[model samples]
Target: MVATTLRSIKSLVPLLDRVLVQRVKAEAKTASGLFLPESSVKELNEARVLAVGPGGLDKDGKRLPMGVSQGDRVLIPQYGGAPVKVGEEEFTLFRDSEILAKINE
Candidate 1:
């Protein structure tokens, strides 16, 4: 089902919204408890924003405000985001509110 839905790497984030996130890498195993893969073990909550959607609606039927821009590194919830595939890349499409923080460095 998801295999056919995903199309491209580019997202359609709007002015007041953002897309959900899915870590690119999977989990890892080692002697020291469990290790997270490099791709998944991003710097804090920072992640390479894969795809984005249009902004959300506002009270007056207007658009709300957005924070980060596409391609920007951001921080999202640790347990949310639905898994999906875009082109050859896998991603998660979670709401911006679920995001914990955004990284500038």
Candidate 2:
């Protein structure tokens, strides 16, 4: 798979059940309209699916379809994804089974 800059993440293509994800930045302001300090802003466990790999082969050698697709919003684990760096951009890589859930919105 090609490592891509965050701005150019769209061009990345994952391989073998891998998934490319861009984390959603924490909100700058709260519901009450209070601006949070940079240090206080918590990173969210949410991310947008940037790219997906072709399904891995099964024991029978048949390709398994991925549960998530490109552009899907998903809930990721708080930790455990492999960190990916590209031209000052940060992203994460996870296996298809590692994805927690798909968000409807």
Candidate 3:
């Protein structure tokens, strides 16, 4: 997995109600300290928010507040979201509404 930093993706920003995030890599080893084979490692549906777009407009033409902000850990769906690449790092773009939940941890 590529290492991502705020400086590397500083130029890219989501437009409206879109969020940019980097997927959290799944652990290759189990709690027992045994290294698992590539096929056994399942991809996690968790990600770190890198950037967020300005809130979308409401029915009254006023801007609504975004649910999540940068640096927030969130739960995403298994599928969907547009894939984005910055330098060697890979990221995903999802609509704010598409984020399943915000992780407290």
Candidate 4:
């Protein structure tokens, strides 16, 4: 059976066409060929730009500029965010200001 998904309402603070995201994968295995379980892995300090919201207001009461685009992976704090669940995956949302840096590779 297929599962249905829910989309979030337009953000109140305005994403300016940007959505902050935290990945669900907590642990990665080492090169020893041994697999590490979720409980054994250390959480990484990273995130990604998941979705883009509506455009921001322009100087004349219209939308302004957007700081990020889709598929852009970024880094964020370990704490300070709201929990969200999309289908079986869980993620967090942070304001653009909360983003520390962007990852190109």
Candidate 5:
């Protein structure tokens, strides 16, 4: 069941106001050069934007532009968004407003 959901995510295109993001993996090693267990590693709120919607419709039915685009690194909220799994890769779909911030680096 999960295997089918993990295929062909590249064909996905988010609708208005939606953005697809892939969560950045936590580091398995510490600065002190010690290996950290999976349970000990903390999941960061950072992710890279994979695809963005055309933006939500305005009052007059006009499409607004999205603040972030594909390949942009963005900060996401700790919770929320619809989880997506693709070929062992996990992703999340969030509204533009739900995105916390954009990472410059």
Candidate 6:
């Protein structure tokens, strides 16, 4: 038999009813090929779901299903998400109930 190595890795796992997401970056250039200045570029309230927590518990101790899942695109509020950073990338965590809406496209 071949030797198998088991390693413990650290990763971000959101708690109950929480969802991890990365903001969708805004375009730096306009349709007419003009580059917008940093001050003029506005941050969007949109993000992509990276991970989701196992749903919250109900009054009877039953687990409720999460509305969003990994790889989903959603709308977030202008404020109130907890910021997180992994390596050189930045992410945010929001409660499932706080996610504004899912983007169909």
**Which prediction has the highest TM-score against the true structure?**
5
Q: lDDT winner between 4 and 6, please give it.
A: 6
Angstrom error at residue 53, model 1: 2.4
Candidate 2's displacement at residue 37, Å, is: 1.9
**CA deviation > 4 Å runs, candidate 2:** 1-7, 30-35
**Model 4 TM-score (2 dp):** 0.66
* Model 5 misplacement above 4 A: 1-6, 31-34
What is the Å distance of residue 69 in model 2 from its true position?
A: 0.4
Residues 42-62, model 4: lDDT tens digits? 777777667656665667878
What is candidate 1's lDDT per residue for 1-105, written digit by digit as tens? Answer: 155353554543423465745453433545587876666644344477755666678788776655555677777766766666667766667676776777778
lDDT of 3: 0.89
Task: Output the better candidate (5/6) by TM-score.
Answer: 5
The window of 10 residues in a row where model 3 has the poorest summed lDDT is 1-10
State in Å the error of residue 35, model 6: 3.0
TM-score, every prediction: 0.61, 0.83, 0.83, 0.66, 0.88, 0.83
Task: List candidate 3 segments past 4 Å from native.
Answer: 1-7, 32-34
Candidate 5: which pairs clash? 6-87
Q: C-alpha displacement of 58 in model 3, angstroms? A: 2.2
Candidate 3 per-residue lDDT, tens place, 1-105, comes to 334455677787898899999999999999999999999999999999999999888999887889999999999999999887666778998999999999996
Clashes per model (N, Cα, C within 3 A): 11, 0, 0, 8, 1, 0
- For candidate 2, lDDT tens digit of each residue in 1-105? 346446666666888899999999998899999999998999899999999999889999888999999999999998787888788778899999999999997
Q: Per-residue CA lDDT of candidate 5, range 19-64, in tens?
A: 9998898899999999998999999999999999999999999998
lDDT of 3 at 92: 93
lDDT of 4 at 28: 69
Decide which is better by TM-score, 2 or 4.
Answer: 2
RMSDs, each prediction? 5.5, 2.9, 3.7, 5.5, 2.2, 7.8
The residue-by-residue lDDT of candidate 6 on 1-105, one tens digit each, is 112132311266789999989999999999999999998888999999989999999999888999999999999999988887655566788999999999998
Candidate 1 — worst ten consecutive residues by lDDT sum? 6-15
**Candidate 5, residue 49: how far the Cα is off, in Å:** 0.2
